[model samples]
Target: MSIKSATPYFLLNGRTEQAIALYQRALGAKTESLQRFGDVDGSCPTAMRNRVMHAMLRVGNAVLMMSDGPEDVKLPEGGNVSVALDFETPAALRQSVEALAATGKVLERVFEAPWGALFGVVQDEFGIQWMVTSPLK
Candidate 1:
């Protein structure tokens, strides 16, 4: 078997549901699978019975995984990863940027760059960072 380089995972402290919903709206992500801790067959700790054990979403060409962090898990002050989106057309790209920005802090609004693309960065309400880009014709 071959191994892929790496996959992105969000360790939501207590808002897996909200974060999932936000991503659905912002990126058109579809939930492919979800496994709740409670759904696990007997054996797992009772404290984790209601937590989100695992979830997978398909957004564009990427797959994102998430889990509700343990109640006692210490959350880091900042997230280290950013999800980047590359759009095919300016209209779609602009629309996505606008929509995503509505519920996030736009670190960089979409704008033309010397590299011949429109690009921006946003930190969504849940603190997940995103980078959006659309190449110029």
Candidate 2:
């Protein structure tokens, strides 16, 4: 069988829900499904009961998977991976950027790049990084 599609899986420590909410507001994304840790096991730690075990978000035509990682593991820095969002218009791009930046930090504000496009980097409040870009015309 051939691979149908690949989605990025974002593993946050304890803020997957908030991140999902932000994504919904920022990109008008839809939540296809979300399961809390407790849903899978009643014996799960109380702290993890409310945490997302798995969640699927539909952004534009892409699906993103997110979860609150296991409680006892230490996560390393998020390196070499980022979600890239492409917008069709400047207004749409700006609106999304503003929404995403409310509780997020801008790594690089959108600007005209030498490559003839507007590019920027931002890390959401939940710690997932994003590369926002749009064509300049």
TM-score of 2: 0.86
**Residue-wise lDDT of candidate 1 within 35-83, one digit each (tens)?**
8887974667888887888999998878999998777887762388887
**Model 1, runs deviating above 4 Å:** 1-5, 41-47
- The lDDT leader among the candidates is 2
Q: What is the lDDT of candidate 1?
A: 0.81
Cα lDDT of model 2 overall? 0.85
Cα RMSD (Å) between model 1 and the true structure? 2.3
What clash pairs does model 2 have?
A: none
133: Cα error in model 1, Å = 0.5
